[model samples]
Target: MADALLEFRGVNTYYGDLHVLKNVDYSIGRGEIVCLLGGNASGKSTTMKTIMGVVRPQSGQVLYDGQEIADLATSERVKRGIAPVLEARRLFPRMTVYENLEIGAYTRKKGPEFDQDLERVYQLFPRVKERRTQISGTLSGGEQQMVAIGRALMSRPKLICMDEPSMGLSPLFVEQVFDIIQEINKQGVTIFMVEQNASMALSIAHRAYVLQTGVVVLSGPAAEMKENEMIKQAYLGEMQVEAA
Candidate 1:
């Protein structure tokens, strides 16, 4: 995986005495969208935390752009071009959309490039720009998700880790959210997402890893996974009957 932008090699993480991630290994190449899929309590969110440095692995490596960063601080990771669109769109409720987005650039100094990135986010999320002066807490759920994604883009990150981007959204919004994710990947930002919606995730993913009880049970190209009998039965709610 010499061309990979992010690599998790033999990563084993624990929560207290609980072994959360066991020898997890995966990679996301530059300009690709990779999804981690699993059911409830399957360590999908823990994988995202490990990458973001919020939860440290007991052993192994997290390499970003060929450099090891498992020991780096969370803020240090952000400075090195990792941004997260956390679950549930954790925006500053009392703050205006404009102010919330500006806070995302706190790791970088104010300058022309930073402002240009803000404009870039606005262009990507026109609804955000329209609601820039509005209170973030007051926007619709879908609009708030857009602002959360816009905030992540404001950081000008090389990689964006999204945790359950479609969670808590209506069917229409879920479709729209997936569309936006594909658009963002087309714009050249690598995406590593943790999702429970396997069908939606695989539709836009270049590759995907299926985690079961903290271990990777399946990994392959998205198109292949879509037709996999095990995946269809387990995640996509499809029934397959064997011929007698």
Candidate 2:
């Protein structure tokens, strides 16, 4: 797409002798919320790894803002405005909330702008602001998730790639997390997320792609995907009727 902020062209990845992503091609437009949905071992997490340069693709290109970043180091990718909220809310257990967030800005110069971005993150997550001095490991699951997101935001990234943001959270926290994701997208940060909860992901996503066994089985606008019979049956746990 002409306005694509991120693009995967013919991406193929492998783990040892086993193949994972299979010639995948997808794009996320500027200011769009795009979700990749799949079941376990369906290559969702591998895709995120490829984009973040955690795992380099054996073939093809991963483009960010029209630049080929497939070979850039993970930290370099962060400097290029790509930040990841990894799965399981991986925060420093021994660090204060403030320290954890400060670590997110390591790629940037320490100055007034960094402080400004920290305040922006705090404003977005008031709960995190209130617990700045507390140990991250002592927070509730929902609060830890908030800190994870706030830390990612501290980088001031143009694109935020979240891996299972709602994973392991309570039902109420899941709802709140998705709400915050929508609010973040509205504020002009493009989001690309990998999620197992198809129903919830589709609800907030502008577009979605379904990965099945390392291949893309479906792709379209979120509303249309929600109504798709196959998606409803398999991912949403609903039965679809056929005309007799």
TM-scores for all predictions: 0.94, 0.95
Root-mean-square deviation per candidate: 3.5, 3.5
Task: State which candidate has the highest lDDT.
Answer: 2
TM-score of 1: 0.94
* Candidate 1, 140-183: lDDT as tens digits: 99999989988888888899999999887887888988998898
Worst 10 residues of 1 by lDDT: 235-244
Clashes of each: 0, 0
Output the lDDT of residue 72, model 1: 94
Task: For candidate 2, write residues 12-89 as lDDT tens digits.
Answer: 999999999999998999999999988789999999989889999999889999999977999999988899998878
Best by TM-score: 2
With a 3 Å backbone cut-off (N, CA, C), the pairs that clash in candidate 2 are none
Q: Model 2 TM-score?
A: 0.95
Candidate 1 error regions (>4 Å): 238-244
